[model samples]
Target: MNLPATGRRVLVSGASRGLGRAVAQAFATNGDRVAVHYGSREDEARATLDSLAGTGHVLVGGDLSDAAGAASIAGRAADGLGGIDVLVNNAAVNLPHPLATTEYKQWAALWQQHVSVNLLATANLCHLAARRMIDAGTGGRIVNIGSRGAFRGEPDHPAYGATKAAVHALGQSLAVSLAPYGIGVASVAPGFFDTERVAHRLSGTEGEAIRAQSPFGRVASAEEIAAAVLWLASPSAEWASGAVLDLNGASHLRT
Candidate 1:
């Protein structure tokens, strides 16, 4: 099938595995110069990099928890690619801590990681990237990956849900704030996904229980979510800024 032809330059965070890897591959397949960023898991990141479709793939690594580091990462990518035309904020964490067991210490740690990777770091990159686009007088797209657990509730991971909610909100805020600079922002939230990393989180009974709620009786694949993201960043979605495309399979919808 013919997919949307991606932009010339793209930066995808958390691109070593899961949904991030899927997204990076999708863009690469469609002819985008993709910079794959990884927080850890150097081997996995490299594996994904080697597996991409385009020769323009580059592997970049940095701990995104630091605001300065995040900005610097953006700068490096812009310099390497001459300028980044697309930024995909897909790195995330969901440390499981129920409200009952959640203490300020745990909450703070989880909050820091989730907020930094999911929101703060993303915003930092967006801030820098938007300026680059503005200076070039060319518009760009920022696509963020969020979670359905945020809008509803993830019984075991309060930090994940809260941070994703913030991500959702940030997308909208950036849409209006960055539009003047000719930048667009949007989010894609996927429900209970069947990813390699999620093996422990949703296995045996737990996985089956969650899958029951999905009308399709299954979790979504990384490619499914990636396709939605591709469509969002495609030229067709240029006029679709501020959209939060849902890939929940009607599981979260209450009739």
Candidate 2:
């Protein structure tokens, strides 16, 4: 598997906006043809496709909370890109479901949602993409979007934190198993960043506190995290497989 430096085929899940959009743009800017995937934001996904630098970018939409949908997304992405050389598992669900205040049924439902979307979808996509990479015998790269809450704890969103922790572990396990097939797997644990989805939280007093969590007194831009994802998916980052790079602006440090 002789991987090229650029102009590869990439599949980025949840690329409709925010971090996903930034990641897709980064890869496109790097000369790779990207498959911009969205679960329910087709219009925004198309916008992301139009904003990409190079041509050949395509929009793929499907539910990722199930195995069949995962397969369909992967299949469409591979077909659109001709083949997948890199895959970014960026789709995830992070709903707030604090244990103390939430009802029992709501808690169980949210837990299921988080696990299905965050953990299972990622694992399923990895399997689908890696299978193609293995069959092609050309090797590939897979980058999973994890969360800092996996380590620091998501007391307000325990399911999100737990599922993300599972995702990190899943990437590590795949990094080991897929290496023999020339597939590199890695995960990025990003802390609070400036994204439209969480823009409200980054305002007034609460926003200040969030920014203060990092000694730098600032939150990261989507592009910053995208840069790291791009590097990890590059041909040079084969040695970095199995690593969980933290992009938390030093907000949470592990011992």
Candidate 3:
């Protein structure tokens, strides 16, 4: 298959593993220079970097919980890749915090952690990246990895759901706010994916129930989500800005 013809400077956050790793590989395979960003897994991040098909791929590390560090990631990537043409905000946490079962204090702590990494950090990156893109006067693309739970609901991880919904909203708001500067912002809302983190669940007794959620009897693959992200980041997809493209397999439908 023909990779993207245009060689863009792409930065993918949380590229240490799973879906983020796949997204980075997709961009690199398509002839783009990639900056692989990781929060805590430097080894895995380097593995992702080395797995890329092309040259000029670099590994970036930072704690997403730190607002300053999150903002710095964009600049570091720009420096590493020469300039960033696409930014993929994929770093996130999905810790369980079921309101019905958790104490108020614990729930509050989880909420703070979720908000700091998923929303605040993501917002800061968007801001810094948009500014850089604007200053360059060159068009760019931003693809955020949201979740179907944002709409369908995540009772166990309400903060995750809420933040993802906000992320989708933030993308739409930035799409309009940054259009004049030639920056296109969009998001992908994916259902449960077959990543290392969820392998156990996918293979356990609950696995059948999970698969039954979709008629296809399967969950999404990292590559599948990566493809959607690549399309959204493509120049041809500029018209899709502000769109929250759903990657769920009819498991959760919204009006």
lDDT of each: 0.83, 0.95, 0.91
lDDT by residue for model 3 (1-255), tens? 111446988989899999999999999999999999999899999999999998999888998788789777877899998887888999999999998899999999999999998999889888887787887778799999999999999999999999999999999999999888888899999998899999999987799899889888899999999999999999788889999999989998899
Report the lDDT tens digits of candidate 2 across residue range 1-255: 887779999999999999999999999999999999999988999999999998999899999998999999999999988999999999999999988999999999999999999999999999999999999999999999999999999999999999999999999999999999999999999999999999999989999999999999999999999999999999999999999999999999998
Model 2 scores a TM of: 0.99
Question: How many Å off is the CA of 221 in candidate 3?
Answer: 0.5
Off by over 4 Å in 2: none
Expressed as tens digits, the lDDT of each residue in 78-171 for candidate 1 is 7777788888999887777786878888777877777777778777777877788777776788999988887788888877888888888989
For all candidates, the clash counts are: 0, 0, 0
- Of models 2 and 3, which has the larger TM-score? 2
Give TM-scores for every candidate, taking all chains together and pairing residue i with residue i.
0.93, 0.99, 0.97
**Of 1 and 3, the candidate ranking higher by lDDT:** 3
Best model number under TM-score: 2
The order by descending TM-score is: 2, 3, 1
